[model samples]
Target: PGKDKGKDMILLTKMDKRPPNWTFVFAVDVARSGSVSADYSVAIGIAYNSISQEKQICYFWRSKGLKISEQAEEIAEISKNFNHPYLLVEQNNMGQDMIDELTDKYNVNVEAITTGAHTTGKNIKKEELIRFLISAFEHEKITIPRGDEYSREQMSILEDELTKFCAIPTPAGNELFQGVGAHDDCVIALALANRATQTVGIPFAVTLGPGRTQAGGVYSALLQATRGESDIEKMIKLGIIK
Candidate 1:
């Protein structure tokens, strides 16, 4: 009787398991025309961490300011390794046709965010855009992840170049670059991606209507989960969150 009771008392149990969340990835490229070369050829990879709002990663790569096709191929290889959804590219001297070819051959989505818009004087308005980017970095709203030594060096060089260049307004009421032959296109492209992601925030599931209908909201729950109480309150007061 005792043995029968012990056997009857045995029980089976199951543990709750949830799948891990995957991060969204975005890649960006910037190019510039070379004086020596007939065509434009330069590239940079800017990556973003969709899971975290604060950390944005950038990778810099450079090639002869010639051979747009070759440069595009390199980007394809990089994209494959990174596995990003879309590549935000600058459409300047290379032309849209080249971009189209690259996208078709590489099976990549390429979005053209800007043409060749360099920093110029009479462009006081342009400074505001630059300031917004700086603010995002200063406020910890955007981040640039550390890269290898070469990448770090390239970033430093670009930062220095950006500082030397200033936007000034001219009599024409248009902005022009104070520093001639200095381009901030690459830096601006990277900044654009970072700004876009942060400004858009992340999407989340919501409930609407009488039934349990799922809806989408701008703010990502992951953002709240990552923030401290003070930060959360600040975001709420700033109307960045609900």
Candidate 2:
């Protein structure tokens, strides 16, 4: 969306239709600063047909100032509208309040994550979360709305954050992914949605081409995707899956 942005595929492929076998899931990233102060973002990802579980549907909700109950109302509607999506809310800071609002008040069976490591039960770092999404992109296994307004609004935020997203090797040899002066609420939500997709596997398997292993290749694949195409159609043309 900016100068020379498509040169390296800095964005992901965008699509419209969800495959017939896809199932939806919801994820939320609650702000820690204040219930209504910091950014609150949620995204829905659809796990399309295959064992690899490519995410082909992405819808986003984001706002700066909103009470937990207000957010819960919107989430409830989103869940109901999306076939009762499994909700995963980040359980840090005011997030517990959000869960209480959704579960106790809204009657949503929402799941909670203490941190990025909470999902897989193995101390999975936030770095792994960021890298997981990136790896999905590198393997050409993720999709987003092509030009839909609400979806684009969320993808725009996600892309802006991704630009500042980076990793550095620490003295302890652990890699950390962080955005400078930016937040990854949407990105983490998207990642969580995709992880949920992995668990609800479909019957078929998607055969991916050799992944873009090099950084440059990965960037090219991430940013250079087939536009105005459906997921299976796009992958077929890109030679990623057949």
Q: Which predicted model would earn the best TM-score?
A: 2
CA displacement after TM-score superposition, residue 136 of candidate 1 (Å): 2.0
Task: Please state the error at residue 215 of candidate 1 in Å.
Answer: 31
Candidate 1 lDDT score relative to the true structure = 0.44
Task: Give the TM-scores of the predictions, in the order they appear.
Answer: 0.56, 0.69
User: Please, what are the lDDT tens digits per residue for candidate 2 over residues 18-120?
Assistant: 5566566667887665446566656554545565455665566667577677778888877776666677777777788988998987788588766554435
Kindly give the number of clashing pairs for every candidate: 12, 3
- Report each candidate's C-alpha RMSD, comma-separated, in the order given: 16.4, 8.8
Error of 2 at 80 (Å): 0.8
In model 2, which residue pairs have backbone atoms overlapping below 3 Å?
9-223, 9-224, 10-223
Per-residue lDDT of candidate 1, residues 1-242 (tens digit): 11121121111111112123222234344344434544224344433344654433444555556455666677677666555445655454454545786778877766654423343431213334444444444344443332345545565654544445454556976444332334555555544454345333463212242222232233334333544323223333444421
lDDT (0-100) at residue 191 of candidate 2?
A: 65
